[model samples]
Target: MQNIGKIVVVAAATLSLAACGQGAKTQAAAPAGPPVPPSSAAPAPQSKGRECAADDIKTTGKFGEKPTITIPDDCDPPKKLITKDLSEGTGNGAKAGQKLQMNYHLVTWSNKQVLDSSFDSKPFELNLGAGEVIPGWDQGLAGIKQGGRRLLIIPPDLAYGQGGRGIEPNETLVFVTDAVSVPAG
Candidate 1:
């Protein structure tokens, strides 16, 4: 039993050292502590952002259902990505380097128009923090729990910087995302 304990400690130390060596380029484990209350538990890791301003946008729907989002024509967005949970979920929290599946509704901030949505079709699947998706999603979706619905307002720098195939130049994107699942190991 003593030898087993020593091996466990050594393995944990090695993992900690490896994680530290990777720096900010790699995501770290959540801080160890007592359970965080639901109200304060879902903020994305390392995001320098605040809660959503109520008047900045509006949505009508329950979690697990498609939401109707409205962005007033004169609404001005913040420079950084902001997240707000419409409903808190119970499950393992999302993290970087995991394969995540989400149901998302996307809108263009300037026109207040929906650009694309996965509600009517298949859920979108992507490896979190991978370049397969835009940086906004890579950063905004971290730490979300399975079944949680998050509202994300992504600035131009995080979305498509200038323009992409279907997005406008310097577009500030708005998304309502549901963390459908993260496959278990």
Candidate 2:
């Protein structure tokens, strides 16, 4: 056993019981304490963002169901991404550079049609700021605790911009997500 501060590393010999050899475990055994080189410690994750201020965008419907979005006529989305946590989670908060799994639903600003949904498939895995997803999702979901439900309103710049993936040009996107896990740093 190794101790750093109050942490204890309970090192044990892991045995392979299967005939077929497995390559390796994805997750590493966490160190008993902080990194030996304190300078190498990862920076803390950004806290959950503030609630949306765009009065034009409104949501009406229960969670875990197809959400209904109401967009006021001639209304524009906020320049910055707006985020709101509908329900608190029960897991740890994530840090920068860490990967996470989430279930999400996305819709266009003009028409409230669901462009994509993870509810029909598996949870989407992404590393924070790793450029696997849109900037809004990366910035908005940062530091979000696991199992938490959050809503994000992303502007065109943060979304697809002039050329959208499946929607119109310069379209703003709305996302509702469930942060399933936020591993310890």
Candidate 3:
């Protein structure tokens, strides 16, 4: 009986660690968007894939599935954050301290394996400048308008660094995102 009890405790502990993104992620809260007020103006079209025109990474996927990414096998990570606009938007751009709903795809630069993507599930909500996400996100996401799509190529220093979640230590990360909404403060 004592041996069984120990086994159960160890199993529970391991499960707990895995639940914390084992270095992956947490289940995001339900999707929420800006409260739209009825108007006569037609809504602007949302941006989609156009990755290769802007950066070295290439991606293929629709709005609701995991995207496939292709990067040059020998390409090196840039020293600074690379924010490439895939498409433009007319809505208010994201800013610090505002709540935002965004669709994102994250892949590690080392092995080119996808780590996370909102396109697989509900759009992720982030409180800008709140430290809920990595520093690269807060800095790279700034100035992008709602309805815009962008590519953020974040170097290892701006990402998980040595204490990597599921990612390798000091891994650079690549993210393609659509700035869906920024609700009023």
Candidate 4:
């Protein structure tokens, strides 16, 4: 009788432990999917494939001003543009001078594979035309409005050139950039 009582207690304890382990596993797996949006019940769809020239990109907003030039046909078409308001500051609209803070998404021109992105965390800050960035950035950003979103299609000459930068040597580059903020004078 004593031995049987001990066996039953041990069995119950083992089952309790197994239940706890399963609970822990369920908790661990719950957060792996896409994060739930606060306002919407459904998660936003993740982008797939290369964001190509034919793709319709959209700009939802802008910070400062809008450019007047017609969107070049040769240039990659933007998904959207923020046309609601225009504001101004001390920074030059196109010239690269002080450091600019931007959120950028880069992809290979050939494959449209995303090479890097700074959308989730924070905007990237870099000095324009200071050789700190690729030649395409220095030149392509020349006439862009300060608070605008622009798509840059960079030929090899303006990008990695012959030697290429990492996997991008001599390859054409494509970038979608949001000029989030430029330093005020």
Best by TM-score: 1
Superior by TM-score: candidate 2 or candidate 3: 3
Error of 2 at 89 (Å): 1.0
Clashing pairs in model 1, backbone N/Cα/C closer than 3 A: none
Candidate 3 lDDT over residue span 87-183, tens digit each: 7766777888988888999888766788888886788999888889999999999888877777888877888876457876557788888887866
Best by lDDT: 1
**Candidate 4 displacement at residue 12 in angstroms:** 87
Q: How high is the CA lDDT of each candidate model?
A: 0.81, 0.70, 0.75, 0.58
- 1-185 per-residue lDDT for model 1 (tens digits): 99999999999999998877876444345555433447964443343344336456888777678888997644356788888888887677788899999999998876678899899997899999888899999999988888889998899899998778688666788999998986653
- The order by descending lDDT is 1, 3, 2, 4
Give the per-residue Cα lDDT of candidate 1 at 42: 41
Best-to-worst order by TM-score is 1, 3, 2, 4
Per-candidate TM-scores read 0.68, 0.63, 0.65, 0.49
Tell me the tens digit of each residue's lDDT in model 2 across 1-185. Answer: 33653342222223333212343332245445323436774454233343336555676544455455665544455667888887777666666699998888888865667888887888889998888888888888987888777888998888887655786666778888888667866
Quote the positional error of residue 38 for candidate 4 in Å: 49
Q: Candidate 2 at residue 3, lDDT?
A: 64
| RMSD in order of candidates | 19.1, 20.8, 17.7, 13.0
- In model 3, the runs with Cα more than 4 Å from the true position are 1-54, 61-66
Clashes of 3: 3
Q: Give the runs in model 2 whose Cα sits over 4 Å from its true position.
A: 1-56, 60-66
Clashes (N, CA, C under 3 Å) per candidate: 0, 0, 3, 6
